[model samples]
Target: MDLSRQRCRLWKELVLVASLLALGICQASGQIDINPDSLIGVETYRTRLVLENVTSDSQQNGPMFTGRESVLKTGDLHIRGSQLNDTGNYTVRVDAINGTQRATGWLKIQELEIPGISVNATSVVEDIDSVAAICYTNDTNVMWYVNSAPVSSNNRMTISPDTKTLIIQRIERFDSPLQCSIEIIPEIFGRSELIQLTVAYGPYGMTLTSMPNHLSGVVSAEIGTPVEMKCTAYSRPESQYRWFHNGSLLSFSGENISLPSLTWDQMGSYRCVVGNSVTQLTFYQRLQVQVPWRPKPAQKRVFTVSGSYVVVLIVVTVLGGVVFCATLIYILFKHYSTRTNRLI
Candidate 1:
């Protein structure tokens, strides 16, 4: 009876060991986590273990070395230098004496955070060829985008031989907001901060504008009235203004100037020169000043009002003329009367 009891105890010990081994198999079916850019190894205690890196055939397209093939090895699978594409579920199978056991669980692949980026030249001439922008990271296969569109090898833009640099030949207006995105395709993509590019060009249509703008590039006003004029130009970088009068610098720096009064000397050639620092371009304009004709002064006139002196002079002249006329008439009448009476 004691021997039979010993046999029963041995059977119970063997069954307990088998139960523990089955529990370990169930635990292996659960999720297994790992980060990229490091080494990872998954092991199972079984007669034979097979691991299938089936990400390429499945929904995932992450970069992986094994592609879509399976491997049979001693109960352990080793992966070296993992990347973004190594993420997803790995098929685990165990071939035991009883039967074959299979399970699926996640193998997490954490991505490397995107880093800061820079451009060789933020601003380039409008017609300049060969504009380069580099994405700074140790990661491989960086993609570039312009205005939210994928950039590929073409006449307008091309990728470098190493695929680390993006070259844009003959920049265009839409080249602003250039970006670099790092991803393994289909999923797991991180974009760098946007880096804007400016196209430097001309300082065109230079003119002297005023409140009234007496004329194009000319400011005219009354000689004593205050007059103000502004120098204006267009360019990628704003142009600087300089004012000169008769070959003499009137202002060192300013966009606009005010004149208190105009004189004969100030009525000569007035020039306004504009310069663009980016394009190294300089242009100037000259304005002529003329004075209007002035009218001559008028002659002076005199007037008087006196009554007594005028009356006395008029009466004396009339009385003397009357007396002389009467005396001459009396002598002539006496002579004429005597001759006429004798004849009758």
Candidate 2:
């Protein structure tokens, strides 16, 4: 009886060991995870496993691939230094106790180079000069931008067949700081240096304003009063200004002018001529200036009453003088008569 019990215990221990070994062999053939893409000179790990006698079509006993063990007892295929020629499909196989399992993947290695841009001219005249710009890159994926916004073919602009060159028949001043970029993927990209464009524009929309505004195209002010005028126009390189009076050019040339004291000689039709040298464009504005004639000084005034009071005073003076003369004559006549009668 003792011998039989010992035999049964030995058999049970052997079966338990075999079952544990089978479970370990099944766990060793776990799923594989790999990086599909990598950059040149970068280290890449293709897979992680603990399977027995692992092999891959990408690895042919070369020094480029080295094997390492992870903390979880997982085997890893390590690429020491990736190269441009090492881009292709890869297949890995593992020999397990159950059967031969396989996992396949693709690896793409790329070499990135700096991008550049070239242009025919940096400065151009608006509506007269055309511009061409080209991007330099080995990549076929190209994109263009103007002022940080994407650009496309339009009536005034066109793109080349390969989308590497951009042409503008009539470049405007508002379009500047062009840029080009290569998009390898959503996460990988390269950009070129910004190229600025200088466009010379016009001298249009001319306006002349006075400090004391004019009424009905006429500037009226009193003699000896100061007047000021300012002229302005829209331009790229700053417009040149000239002043004219009565169809004759003045000695002064600027955007603003002041007449210290307005006079007859300084009054007439005033004009402001604005011109651009680069674009060879011109504009002008006109206004009439009039100085009113000054009036003369008045004579001194005397204190006097109304016409009716003057008439009353003259009549009263005449009556008083007549009464006094009549009284004196009467008294003299009476004296003469008394003397004569006494003598008789």
Best TM-score among the predictions, by candidate number: 2
Provide the lDDT at 24 for model 1. 34
Worst 10 residues of 2 by lDDT: 6-15
Best candidate, lDDT: 2
TM-scores for every predicted model: 0.47, 0.56
Provide C-alpha RMSD values for all models, in order.
Answer: 17.9, 18.2
lDDT of 1 by residue, 1-344 (tens): 12112111111111111221444332223322222312222211111123332111111122332432222222233444454444445444443334444444444345445746788888887666357888877668788888889878898788887667888888865688878877633555667899988877667788776544556545555566666667788877778788898889984677787777766666666788988787788898877555544678896876654688668767777887888788889889998999999999
| Cα-based lDDT for every prediction | 0.59, 0.67
Candidate 2 off by > 4 Å? 1-111, 292-344
TM-score of 1: 0.47
Model 2 TM-score, 2 decimals: 0.56
Model 2: per-residue Cα lDDT over 1-344, one tens digit each: 12112111111111111221344432333454333422222123222222233322111233322333111223334343444444544444444455545554454555445579989999999888988989998777778888888899999889898989999888888678888888754555567899999899988778889967987767888779999999999898999999999999999899998999888788889999999999999888888888644688999999998999999988889998999899999999999999999999
